[model samples]
Target: MARLTKKQKEALAKIEKGKLYSVDEASALIKDVTNTKFDSSVDIAVRLGVDPRKANQMVRGVVSLPHGTGKDMKVLALVTPDKEAEAKEAGADYVGLDEYLDKIKSGWTDVDVIITMPSVMGKLGPLGRVLGPRGLMPNPKTGTVTMDVAKAVTEVKAGKIDFKVDKTGIVHAAIGKASFSADKIAGNANELLTTLIKLKPTTAKGVYVKSIFMSSTMSPSIAVDPKIG
Candidate 1:
């Protein structure tokens, strides 16, 4: 195992061993543990008791964090000329269709989120191989594929994020940045946890939420009470 740095050891020591912290407590403690010079991202991992391989138990949904995600989301609006003006006004960084499609075809997915119109989705089908793995595909369920291109772009820029359970049945997402106040971190974390609870598949059996962990980039994980939600 890689040896822990002095700072890492100190951060780890702050957490009480075998104690499950409440959401607010964990959120505040993560700030104290994060020692990075840069504003590290506060991430939450929820382990659910569901088999993702079973389609009936799959969990996926979106939530709008009350305090925006600290990162400025780079949005690419893949719309036709008729919608370009509205898309740009909605804070989309890149607003265009064919050229951007060509760029993606060349493996250039520079934007964080891609919002496209329903008509444009057909054109995107061929680029699925390039976008799917990156989680950049415009899915209708996530509101990425819509007639209201501006609405989609605006929501994404306003801290709306979609999450899906991975093969291991864990949903992981960055809730906020370490620079945010402890209250903001806790607010965002709670919002996500509430959304996950609402999205719990009926087929899922036993403890829907098996475990919860909160941490900042490069910080040791802090166990959060699964029932806090």
Candidate 2:
């Protein structure tokens, strides 16, 4: 139920599928076909021929969301004796206090998210190479290292989405599923768009939030109207 203007339709048709581009690449494509400024949500949406809200999150660190990410995150928690039972009761996928430090070398790959207590930081330091690249390392700054087990697990399940501004300062995140009510997706999209816009880096140039695409897992995106909320 979204309508595209003639110019917008042309821009959308120009972009090749599955070809991700940097901001400059994106801008050049628009200028080549249409001389309009590639600086607004509408412009970016038209260029991609898809909703900007459909883009998956580009998060750098992990956090626990109050409502969870809506995806089942296999969580591995590192806790001491005092907090061991609390972790299991909170639905942690794997809970322990370093009794299985050796196991951390193996099953971590099978898990989606990893949570570690402050005390275990010393031991986990060695895993910087193994888990860091996968974005699984627990760090306090990113809110991955936490003492609260229940809060962490609950948020992971709800959709503790994470995102980082790309080199171009564009923050991307999936707003919702295509079958979701437009209003619902719109609300979520607005929330994320607003947050990223507000969190723009002082050093970054040009527009902040950039393009948004909302689409199903395998379907094309439907551009959502980006409103300043």
Candidate 3:
């Protein structure tokens, strides 16, 4: 195994062993532990007591962070001519149909979120191979595929994010950036935790939230109290 660096060892020393920190405490501690020169993304991992393989226990949903994700999400509005103006007005970084579709067909997925209308979905179906793997396929369930292009684009640009439980039954998401104030980080973490609690499946018995961890890029994970909402 690779040895821990001096910084990594120092970071681990700050975290008390066997101590499960509260959301507020973990939020603050993560900032102190993250030593990256650039602003690092603060992520949360929630282990749920459910089998993701079971259809009845699958968990997935979207939540708008209270303080907005510190990073500005780049949005591509794939709309018809009439909706182009609306999409542009809603802060979409790119707006168009055929030209953009051609770009995507040629393996150009430079944007983060893609917002397209239902009518445009049929055209996108053939390009699913290029978009699906990258998690950029716009889905109606996540509000990315809709007739209201403006609303979808605006929401994505305003810190709205969708998350799904992985095979290990852990729901992971980036809540905010380490540069944000402790209060902002804690607020975002609480918002995501609260949303996960509300989305608990009835089929999921026993403890819904098994464990929670908060960490930043290249930083040691800080164990957060699972009971926190």
Best by lDDT: 1
lDDT of 3 by residue, 68-132 (tens): 89998999999999999999999999999999999999999999999999999999999999998
Native-referenced Cα lDDT, model 1: 0.95
The better candidate by lDDT, 1 or 3, is 1
lDDT per prediction? 0.95, 0.54, 0.94
Error of 1 at 45 (Å): 0.5
* lDDT for residue 107 in candidate 1, whole number 0-100: 91
Compute the lDDT of residue 16 as modeled in candidate 3. 97
- In candidate 3, position 218 carries an lDDT of 97
RMSD to the true structure for each prediction, in A, is 0.7, 11.2, 1.0
Report the alpha-carbon TM-score of model 1 versus the true structure. Answer: 0.99
Please report how far candidate 2 places residue 117 from its true position, in Å. Answer: 1.4
TM-score rank order: 1, 3, 2
Predicted structure with the largest TM-score when compared to the true one:
1
lDDT of 3 at 77: 95
